[model samples]
Target chain A: PSETHRNAAEARQNTLTKPPGSLGALERIAIQLAALQETERPCADNVQIVLFAGDHGVTAQGISAFPSAVTVEMLRNFASGGAAISVLARKLDARLEVVDAGTLATSEVAGVVTDKPCHGTRDFATTPAMTPDETAFAFDTGRRAVARTVDRGAHLLIFGEMGIGNTTSAAAVAAALLGKAANDLVGAGTGLDSDGIRHKARVIDAALDLHGLKAPDVPAADVLMKVGGLEIAALAGAIVAAAQSRIPVLVDGFIVTAAALAATRLNPSCADWLIYSHRSSEQGHRLILEALDAEPLLDLKMRLGEGSGAAVALSVVRLACALHGEMATFAEAHVSESL
Target chain B: PSETHRNAAEARQNTLTKPPGSLGALERIAIQLAALQETERPCADNVQIVLFAGDHGVTAQGISAFPSAVTVEMLRNFASGGAAISVLARKLDARLEVVDAGTLATSEVAGVVTDKPCHGTRDFATTPAMTPDETAFAFDTGRRAVARTVDRGAHLLIFGEMGIGNTTSAAAVAAALLGKAANDLVGAGTGLDSDGIRHKARVIDAALDLHGLKAPDVPAADVLMKVGGLEIAALAGAIVAAAQSRIPVLVDGFIVTAAALAATRLNPSCADWLIYSHRSSEQGHRLILEALDAEPLLDLKMRLGEGSGAAVALSVVRLACALHGEMATFAEAHVSESL
Candidate 1:
């Protein structure tokens, strides 16, 4: 963090018309942005939403409500401005990039960037999801995507994922990292019923036992190869790369947070660059947020992925910047200060 | 609530791309707007923020950090577009109306309504803050202000207040309504140190004792006359009148919620027309929200209290309307539904 810029922002906050710290998270957000941007005045004018799409081999377990084909279908929905994220991206005026890291379906969508290292991962219930080399390749794909956006003058990056049954994979990854049983971290993905949740948990538990991965001891890369989906690996890569590039990352819902967990585990410094967007209504999202010690910006009980939460929260982030840059100081407004 | 329109909206929500009840508060807001507006397609396009400014005699007790004169000063700042709410009004493209309900200063500001029932409320620390007639007039001022805006095409109303030392009066009113001690409902207003908060609590406790108000029995008008500021009284009146007029009310922070509490006491049905904007970090705000059973749209810890939270939340409300009205249904999007 840039202490000088943060100090300057804090000093400016005290001089605003309202009482000191009255703006709450907005005041903190301004200071954080100042520190991240290394400037007294921070702007979030150029925002980009990078959506990573992949297919989860764990779908073979029949855990998710939707079919794996829905992953590629949603990519087309995103490109055609029919998905939730597409609507939000237009509403927020953010550039939307759909990256197909790896999907079972062939990539022929017009706007989606196809850069898969594998068609999909092996079903983790029986075997590791991805080879180590393929995991690294997915990570590099994420890094390069962020680098390209930063080169295009994007100051803020929002990461979202689209993968059927990806939440099961995220749970498996989280279970390994937190050293918890699958029952503790598993949840209904894409509107699962009670029975579906039990089935999902069993699948995750079997995957963990199959891979012999344990929390806090397994390397992040190995965990990604063993249980993570291609989109999750890419998201982790994007988060780390964004931090390395000094660009802030706005993390979406549960799946994105699992990627953040992996990113922070790989490099603790990446956590500093992450801005949690909202608390998803998905059951295990709270555990992921608690694990990261994250305070999300909103909690509207939204559980839909596709960076929708981050896109919805982008307005608050922009308003924070606007208030920081535009509101008159007490001296300028001639308003009285605290006695 | 219009059951017909609400039923229509609920049906539409189930058909949206996400799962049933997935959008959380956004879904509820859309349904509420439909019921209040009595339209199949609700719109929050014409939004107005009515900020009531007044002075409080309790400033003589040293309860607040800022002077009462700052109320009038901030009115000028609001008019000149230099305040937090002013910037937010511009950003949200909402109309801003500053009402000089009862500030001590002479109302010569160009854009302010200058409709004071009196110069200011009498200090309730010694006696009733307002006479019954004066309280009635303040309510009428609020009623007519909202009526004129509705006549001018405002579909949504946001109520905010500007008054130094008003938090003490709000606490006093809340204590009477909630059957709580003053300390339980008092907070540091505008950067008061710990000692000031204790002093403010004592003042409110004394006022509650002076009024001889017991919970669940105190009449709304009597409570307003006993402890409410002219601006808060006006806000209460506006809320009641807005509900009568079938316009949705987007309520602001602590002081505004106190007014809402009073309004709900006057007519319990008004709560149906109210939408809480955000949860204030102010100490007593949670109590007031709990009393109202309010589920605020945002929890930014904001306590600026000039309808700033309401204005900030307007974006989300607007987006909810847009998504409700614009998004393609499951059939239109050809998205698969959960089995």
Candidate 2:
């Protein structure tokens, strides 16, 4: 079946409306998925987005430019259809659902549903890593979220994170996954200056040392529980579940890539379902992309850490699918491909 | 009158199909033109792309990564619809017409028209620049091209250029226009590395020093006659034509920006019809943009010196116009704007 899906994708690509490689990397992805799902008309019709909100204890350490309250404000923004991601979802004609995995506030907000497993995690340098049980539950949170999406017939999903200082968390997770120096992966999150970047890197290095972070030889699920955010954990679960259910997942920027890395670590087959949308300008993004052996569709130096990149690339993908599924081939068009 | 156009642009932005600023910089351009034409239904229906092909005397200096033969090859590619710009023009459903104002080649090729006023100019460093008469003819060539497009009912225009070592020419033009050293404006065109960059800078400095180049104090036309390319002259003429005809002319990247600089220098009123497309990743693009006080629509780091960036942004403009023209307002949708 592994070989079967890939072969079908190849055949579908060959039969697509446009000339081979005319749409460049986009055509390649459409064909890759066609083979994976073994369908001629692979559609991202049931597109779903999961917004993972969490509080990073490192925010208290002043690693980010924005206050932690911005995360709550942004979560409300996502729910109220006022944020960039909301506009992007509308642009892609996709539905968005928000999940509050772990925020510092105890009471749940009315608009955004609280799937809060805990208020927030303790600072890694100042405490023991999150309990293994909390980690597992976080991963399950993502899986359950995908199950709900599946119930609504969502075949394509996007996992986006909204949290201040989460870039620090992402850097740590990326460092652990790729076995890179934490400082090299740390970048100016939300437009920090050189001094701020230096401070953020130091913070990540401190966390890595205290946590003794290492790339695991075990499953991605284990890795997520060990050093990942509740949001990252949930995304990992969602990725695995989507693959298991034959759904395609478009991985957004740094945070979401960290989640996908965790998922593939658990089940290598999950990589088959992942489509990288764009290369974030973040320092950690290139390394993550390299680890996944994935090439992004666009490189506009976009550092917006939402599912915005994925949502934008979705238009290109949908166009690719339409071109592949709808365009007349050279044989059909009676045009010579002499060049 | 200027205030009227400005206010009309603002009003049109409010009326366009999408939310304000949703189409970003593109909506700004369409609105500006709507105001200029004093019309609500601003259409890009008769879109004209005038491709100006010329041979830079600098090609003899071995400044480009591509051989001068590429100019001819690509002109053929444009004619045959095989180049990236060709594909993009087709994608945008634009009418592309080629003009061979000058080329090193002595005669016309089969598919391309021969409109050369000169085989090529004398090397600028070793000569008294293009004579006033030659520059005037080149400008006239551009005027005639725009007139033909206007006759064909082109309501909007795009000016494009093709020549090996054109970036070298463009950098010199940008430096002169922006009152900066030529070295500051030179960049690695078509993928030159650090070494190539150093050579380019040195070459520009040497050329400017050798020719005793100075920023033009007069209008852009006279400056163009002294220093601009036949293609650039033609483009400047086209921009003048667009202004006179009240057609919105989308200025492309650095080369087109240079042309705009020339047009505005000659006739300040020509600036009224201009729309700055994406800000190119070209080294001089930012400087050119700043000089024009132009707010470009997209900043995608694109340095593909064809009208590709402008072509892509046209989609955004079309979307804005469509949304402005088609989308249901809150009143029409019977939906209350969230308080």
Candidate 3:
């Protein structure tokens, strides 16, 4: 909250290429970055999109309408560049890499590069699921992914995940982050029926009871290690790494937001570089968005948590930056100035 | 419906360059045209966006938050290419033409063509504002404008309007078209308070009472003469001309929808080429959408009715058509088929 830096950013906003507030949320993003980098020209050039694939044991609980096979099938889809996110990444000219945070599949599929954190976690209903070491490794996996992105000159990063019952996991993470009830945080993920939703909420509440960590100050890393996925931990690492590198991170829908919440908990300054992509239709998304005081670009009632929303919104961000960098100011355009 | 024609369109849908349903609402548009034009390859190559600018006398009633001057100011904005629709038109490579159907200004404005049917109409709450001759002239203005677009090689059309307080006119038109109550059809036009909304409904009801056209059976042309603005008449005529030319038309938000309703009453076949762009957040938009049984491309809670939604959605349509016309099929990509 340095007023000097914030004022400089605000002044730069008057000079960015476009009309005042023409870029909408993107203008706000650049202004925030101006304050963070303490520079007039804040740039986010290298862009990386990380797809974390995982399989939830809750899929066995029949909480999702789609068969669990969709998880692996979609992983192949993401790898082969056929999923919506794949086309979107190509549209944005971003390098897309897939990591097996914990898919049920044993080995790497033909198109996908495999780095299995584990074959999948133990079912949360039965046990603590993953030990602290596994969780730290997951976070390190994300850090490694960031290292790869930084190596490739990706200055801007977007983290996305694909898992069938990941919404249940996302809701639990949101509950842990906000101290909200599981029922309030849970939603019909990927179009779940009422009964399935009820069961998913119950499962989350039961898992929380087993963990016995119900408060916000329970140490973010410890909470994540006990209940978060390898993909979520990796996403957190990527976020933290992006902050450390001074690269702005564009956060996608529910699952990515959950990852962001976990990351912000670890390093509070990480929030400064983050630009929320959309307000998702997922129930837990509002709580997570509110927790971050994040304003999203689009809200199309989309609950598809494959980072497609982020990908679409990324084009808007790029357009914002381009406008900020490209548009003529009032003086240049010779138009009457409102300010 | 002809079974052969329906089946032929279905077969065309199977062959479009993109996935069967990946284009979403654009797929419906393409298929509807495939059935209408009886072609396997549906093209919107020659696209034209016609903007009808007018001034509503009801502005004196204070139904809208934006002043009446915004009508002329935005007209200048459109002509000078500063508005959202202007940018969208440029992005889509679509030709933009503005028609001064009726404005408060009696004289011509620079860089804007005069398609004026009249200088302006009396406030609708007083009486049938425009005579049948004036309405005919307004409708003829649209028809002539469409001919000009066709002359310019436009095979696809978009209908947009720019008139402050037109939403009041639109709600009355919708109430008349659907036989609904005024309150049900009226909404906060250009952002209004509760009092403004109630006044709008009352004004619409009073206009309906003055005309003695309570039920829905009023002829489309009659409706135009009675309750519609000159721009509304122009829009209705544009739809007719697009239908006559067999060119597909993409309809903008609520006001344009009301225009389509007016056109459809004249000739039911006009609906064949009509594509609803997006449902506006305006209260009456959903009812109009449902009544038409039409699905829009995007839903971003936008109520800016200067065809901005339609223009934004056009990018998606162009993308869909481009993908449908350009991309290889699964058989060609050696990828598994099926969305």
- CA-based DockQ, model 2: 0.07
Ranked candidates (lDDT, high to low): 1, 3, 2
For each candidate in the order shown, give its overall lDDT on alpha carbons. 0.88, 0.70, 0.73
What is the model-wide C-alpha lDDT for candidate 1? Answer: 0.88
Candidate 2 lDDT over B1-339, as tens digits, reads: 256656765765554222344333434555676676566646675577778888778666666766666676666666766555666677567888788888776767666656768966656655534778878888888888877777787767888887767788778766766668876787767656677878877777776666556644534554455456777777777788778877788888888898888688778998877887777767777888888899886555556565766765565555445434444443433322221
Model 3 lDDT on a 0 to 1 scale: 0.73
Give lDDT tens digits, candidate 2, residues A1-339: 256756766665654322343344645766766765567556666688888888777776778776776666566667666566676676556888888887765676667768867877667657643677788777787788888887787757888877777788878878877778887788877657788888888877776666667635534444455456777777777789989988888889888888888788788988978988878778888988999999886554556666766766665566456545554444444333322
What TM-score against the true fold does each predicted structure earn? 0.97, 0.62, 0.77
* CA displacement after TM-score superposition, residue A50 of candidate 2 (Å): 1.9
TM-score of the B chain in model 3? 0.92
| lDDT tens readout by residue for model 1, B229-339 | 899999999999999888899999999999999999998989999989899988999999999999899999888899999888888888788778876677777777775
Q: Indicate whether candidate 1 or candidate 2 has the larger DockQ.
A: 1
Docking quality of model 2: it rates as incorrect
Comparing to the true complex, what docking class would candidate 1 get? medium
Candidates 1 onward: DockQ, in order: 0.68, 0.07, 0.12
